[model samples]
Target: MIRLFITRHGQTEWNLEKRFQGSKDSLLTELGEKQAGMLRDRLASQNFDLIYSSHLQRAYRTAEIIKDNREIKIIKDKALSEMKLGDWEGLKYDDVIEKYSKEYDLFWNKPHLFETTSGEGYSELKKRVIGSLKRIIRENDEKNILIVTHTIVIKQIMAYFEKRPLEKLWDLPYIHPTSLSLIEIDDEKTNVKLHGDISHLENNVKEIC
Candidate 1:
């Protein structure tokens, strides 16, 4: 059996500002670092054979915190990065809503039909993320793997495992920063043990954009 522990990076400055990070970069907030520490403490007893993270500083830093001086190697892969938001990369939520109203609506309401002006669409993002996951699974069987990525990336991955349609991408139960999800795969069977779990954060859990 293979155990997959997946999570999103801690909250970032842009997250607090309600700005779109997408492929752009941002530093983690103080609370974000605290969240990572909490997650590190939460999984201190667990062992990971391999750790994969997006090249983004926020995600990579979170992975490092979770590693906590462990000898585990963290492989930074662009395939694990967040969906490219193109023109909306650094724009605030309200600004994006006002500037790109139609595209924003499609993104939240109908992801399958949404198209990016200069970035990747939902299908493109899913294809790359799922492809990376499949490659990882194939390369490392019967191993505990850790993947630290972004909100949209994590959500798309979970949705794929759940066999959910793209149209229902933003259903409910938001993927909070540092939220951990576990999946077990044995032979051809896949089981999701946790999905968007924030029990580690306890009362410190705060919603981010």
Candidate 2:
């Protein structure tokens, strides 16, 4: 069996402002740093055999914060990076809708049919995320693993495990920053025991954009 603890990366200034970050590098806000520290404190007792994170700064930085004094080797993987927003990178939500109405509309309501300009589609992201999961499963053998990644990446990974089509990917609950999701994997089955859990957070904790 394999135990997986998956979390979305901490918040960034763009995230706070509800802007699309895509693959662009963004640093964590002060509140995001606090979130990471809170997570570290909450999960200090949990032992993980392996730690993996997206190559991006935001995700890896969040992992680094949680790692604290632990000696686990951190593995950076491109497969866990956020979706590439292409021309839409760094744009605000409203501007994206006004400027690229067709693309924005399709992305929100019918993601499977939408493709970022010169970028990957949801099916491709699903394939990449599942491929990464396969590799992690084989390597983990029978151990606990932690993956820190972006919202879309986590969503795609969850969709793959739920055996759902890419079109219905967004149907699942939204995964917020610093939220944890637990997965149990056996040779014959993979189960999502929990999703989008923020019980570790304070009552007034700010939501990720």
Candidate 3:
């Protein structure tokens, strides 16, 4: 059996402002750095065999902070990145809602067929994420793995494990930055033990400001 511990990168300036950071590289804020420190302290006791992170700076920096001197094999993958929002990458929620109402509604309200002008659809994102996960599962015999990625990817991973409908992916709980999710994987059984755990940054979860 392989236990997977997944976390979204720490909060960023965009996260603070509730902006769409899809596929765009952004740096973690000061609070985000503090969150990473808190996570490192919280997860110090756990043993991880392999550490995988998104290629984005936020994710890589988060992994670097968490794995400080641990000497674990860390792998970077673009397949685990946040869903690209195309032209909406850095736009604020309210602005996107007002300017691109149709597309925004279709994305947040009905995700099945929503596609941005230059970004990937939810279906395609799911495919790529699951494809990467399958490869990881097949490559490793049995071990604990840590993956640092984005909220959307985390949601899709959990959705895949629960065999839930793709359209209802957003029906799951919200994913906070620096939060930890646990999954148990094996040949016959895939279990989501925990989802969007931000107990490490309990006070900061709502204080993204």
Candidate 4:
């Protein structure tokens, strides 16, 4: 069996401002850094064979903090990064709601029909993420791995493994920043032992689910 501990990157300045990050980058807020520290504390006793992180700074930084000065080389993969939001990368939530209401609605309400004028489609995002996951798992045998990525990436992965319909993408729970989820993979099957865990935060941050 292989134990995969998947987590979202910590909060960022854009997150606080309720802006879309997409492929854009931002610094972690103080709370975001602390959240990563808390995650390190939570998993201090656990042993991991390897750590994989998205190419984004937020995810890489979170992984570094979790390693806590320990000498572990984190593998960076673009496939693990957040879904590119294109023109919406830096837009505020309220603005996107007002201007791109139809697209945003499809994103959350009917993901199968979701596509962006400038961003990546949900189908492409899911394919890349799932493909990356499969390759990672295939390369290792009976190892514990930690993957630090983004909200959309993690949610799509969980939804895929859980055998949910693509049209019901919102059926997946809100993926809290720095939240952890465990997926157990074996020769026969895969199991989602936990999904979107943020109890360690203890109100240090506010997020849906």
Winning candidate number (TM-score): 1
lDDT for 116 in candidate 2 is 68
Predicted structure 3: lDDT: 0.86
**Least accurate stretch of 10 residues (summed lDDT) in model 2?**
200-209
Better of 1 and 2 by lDDT: 1
Clashes of each: 0, 0, 0, 0
Across 82-199, the per-residue lDDT of candidate 1 in tens digits comes to 9999999999999999999999999999988898769889989989999999999999898999999999999899998999999999987789999989999999999999998989
Off by over 4 Å in 4: none
Per-residue lDDT over 43-109 for candidate 3, one digit per residue giving the tens place of the 0 to 100 score: 9999989999999999999999999899898899999989988888898999999999999888877
Q: lDDT for every model?
A: 0.93, 0.86, 0.86, 0.88
Q: In candidate 3, which residue ranges exceed 4 Å CA deviation?
A: none
Q: What TM-score do all the candidates reach, one by one? A: 0.98, 0.96, 0.94, 0.96
On residues 119-201, what C-alpha lDDT tens digit does candidate 4 reach at each position?
Answer: 89998898899999999999977999999999889888888888888887777467887888999999969989989887788
Candidate 2 runs further than 4 Å off: none
The TM-score, computed over Cα atoms with residue i paired to residue i, of candidate 4 is 0.96
Worst 10 residues of 1 by lDDT: 200-209
Whose lDDT is greatest here? Answer: 1
Native-referenced Cα lDDT, model 1: 0.93
TM-score of 1: 0.98
